[model samples]
Target: MTTANFVDRPATAPIGEDLRGRVAFVTGGTRGIGAAISRSLAWQGATVAAGYGSHTAHAEQFRADLAGELQGHAECSVHQGNVGLPDDCRRTINEVIEQHGRLDILINNAGINIDKIVLKMSDDDWMKVLAVNLSGAFFLTQAALKHMVERGSGRIVYVSSLAGEIGNIGQANYASSKSGLFGLTKTVAREAAFQLERAGKLTDTGLGITVNTVTPGYVATEMLASVPEKVIDKVKSSIPLRRLGRPDEIARVVHFLASDASSYITGQVWGVNGGIDM
Candidate 1:
């Protein structure tokens, strides 16, 4: 019998370098896809302030891991705040700007899902999902835009879902909130472009400030841990790749949108799904 050796591989190669000297704030940055994004940005030499709603231990662990991964090449810190709250959103953005002296990227990755069929969903379930997924992004953008517009440069990326692009079973509220992000991204992009144009800082290739969204599909995250095995199998079968998306796979796309390489990309939706909806 011959012994076989196996080597673990990262989902994607690390990319991006122009992020050095930049500051990024990511909501829900402690775990799952948000954690991957935080690590990705920091690894690229950006100062990252990761905001988490709760889970102090998880956030602390993520911060430690980020520091280890960067090994003094970047700065990564964790902040506690609830994106769903207006006051918290304002305060979080203010603190990040005050601490970093500038904000270059804002990634709205915080979201919650209260999955229930429309007939069984309560008003609270519907409103809470919208409050966190949709309104939270809106409020944070409003707060961050003031600084970005003043500087005439910024990047905003919203983490949407495939459920938003297409209807999903038992995700009425989640789907609606995610869908609202599309409108928000486009409107913000248009407004920011206009501002840059007036300042004579806009180029045909890119705006002074760019806004975009990343829609991930069936990612293997803690959020999916509760999903039934049968459902997971069914979803896997539906995907062309026949596997769940890794957080890093989604993070790489986000890293691109956050970096200077994607300056020409704005108001666009980049899907990181395993060709599930295609």
Candidate 2:
């Protein structure tokens, strides 16, 4: 419920110093919500590695941005690749582990929104969303999981949207991918907590990772640049806050999920929509 100003000294991580020296991997972390999450993690003393799809120039710029914000410059790098591909997903994790030696947190935030009526949507439109939104997360998590299981501690969060929870006028593909995340969160948590233990492979702390998803509603970002005026008007009027969420607002919640304060929370999907759904 705290508002943000987006400059100057940042607040401490909600979990205090527990996240110090941790390593975090964030997909689609070059801009928008992803960038905000990365910046917050850096502010909390975690090393962050981000992935991008189509913005090499922005990726290059982040190296400089971190130098100013993080004080010592980020010992990080960005890879330009499609998250939908398994090879690229693996490469993203491998690169992070190779550079940082450990992977403690993973934020699956890479997604594409191709708004269209179900009748008008093409196969390409549907498949593209599934590839990056669903498949990318599956690939990256599977690749990074062995390390997590071996270490028995990790955090994973997905960036979903309000549309997925309560449908929208012209976003079937996007909605499907986001809704799928709720299932992924619960299923992954159940498997780790139950099935792994029955198989005699999980220790009390070995598989104690927390996986969650954050669903944000109508955040201001490049993706919203094309939203119809009428739709924007309708959303703002309906929202109890009477305004759209900023990227950092959503990122702050993500920072909590990646830190120890959320140690008791897992497999939960939190909506950061300014109480829009409630």
Candidate 3:
């Protein structure tokens, strides 16, 4: 009996350089977990488009670091956009496609949180969080999906939060937005499969579209700077690992999902939390 082409790879084969020729677009790619993700993917060989919001100086620095100090096997470019706006999402997607000619991976890691209890949350706070975290992901995915569907190959990964799975205090809007990603991931995975099948690209060894979500627990980043030290200590004690997660830790999982090695996995939520959900 002969094995299928896609199944013929050696079990012990190294998959580290699998993304050598791929192109990735990472929103919020200038800082925090997103920056780490950009670095991780680029290190593995993917040319990256690092999307940032209104941080020109920071974005420039990030681009410089990628192009100079952190230079590796990949080329990295930075793009600016307010993900909360649909126009910005579409525009940035176009820019990446034009710059790279093709986009093989889409990392919807751009998100914002407006921390306010249900009663204390104002209309702007709710809408702003939803627009950036949930709506931005949808718009960006919508744009990228069209291109991916036409090419019949793509990987989409949404970075969510543990707060989405288990409610967080003073973060009703933020939690809701992240939770929405679960439904989006599953639906996009199913729809991409169906579309590829219809296009005759869903062959036994060819089709490669996949969509998944990565939910990280509290990580050490600038986002945590505003939290009181006492609260930080308490958060650390509550985690099973008794410490905050590192950005690279989450980025590694994301790098896997963005690689061909993860072709068989999709529509799943990977929790990179320190056993927080468990």
Using lDDT as the measure, the top candidate is 3
Residue 15's lDDT within candidate 1 is 39
Candidate 1 Cα deviation (angstroms), residue 142: 0.6
Candidates ranked, most accurate by lDDT first? 3, 1, 2
Q: Put down candidate 2 lDDT per residue, 180-250, tens digits, no spaces.
A: 98998888877655644665655644536788999999787766666777777787899999888888788
Off by more than 4 A, model 1: 1-16, 203-207
Summing lDDT over every window of 10 consecutive residues in candidate 3, give the lowest-scoring window: 1-10
Write one digit per residue (lDDT tens) for candidate 3, span 69-148.
Answer: 44456789999999999999999999999999999999999999889889999999999999999999999999999999
Q: Per-residue alpha-carbon lDDT of model 1 for 148-195, expressed as tens digits?
A: 988889999999999999979999999999999999999999998888
Candidates in order, TM-scores: namely 0.92, 0.89, 0.92
Provide the global lDDT of candidate 3 against the true structure.
0.88
Q: What is the lDDT of residue 189 in candidate 1?
A: 96
**lDDT score at residue 7, model 3, on the 0-100 scale:** 23
Worst 10 residues of 1 by lDDT: 1-10
RMSD of each: 3.8, 3.5, 8.5
Question: Using alpha carbons, what is the TM-score of model 2?
Answer: 0.89
